[model samples]
Target: MFAEIKNIKSEKSDLRKFGITIGVILLVIAGFLFWKEKESFQIILAIGITLFIAGIVKPNILKP
Candidate 1:
């Protein structure tokens, strides 16, 4: 029972970390787009690519 509880807690923690990482990435991208006066579609495409790459690289990011 305790092991299951610990696993649940760790999963939540990992999700929260991933959320934070993605949020920061988006914010930086938004700032750059604003600075450059770029199109909104470009921002969306950039974010999509960023997320795809992040998914591929997630294990390294999540490692302690």
Candidate 2:
């Protein structure tokens, strides 16, 4: 369920915004996990950061 590039216009669309929100939440969780010295934190941190950046730079990458 993705909209075409031509339909996105100049601003971030709803999907992009939602993705960004989830990414931020994941990042926060990852930070907390890191503070607690959890090993899985690295994986979560990576995914979180990637999603966060992608959500802003290329949101369509997450589609499909």
List the RMSD of every prediction in angstroms: 8.6, 4.8
User: What TM-score, computed on C-alpha atoms, does each candidate reach?
Assistant: 0.47, 0.73
lDDT of 2 by residue, 1-64 (tens): 2567555544457557766888899999999998999999999888888888888888877664
> lDDT values of the candidates?
0.58, 0.79
**Which residue window of length 10 is worst by lDDT in model 2?**
1-10
lDDT of 1 by residue, 1-64 (tens): 8667656533545655664567567767777777788877476557655654554455344432
Candidate 2 stretches greater than 4 Å from native: 1-12
**Model 2 TM-score?**
0.73
Best by lDDT: 2
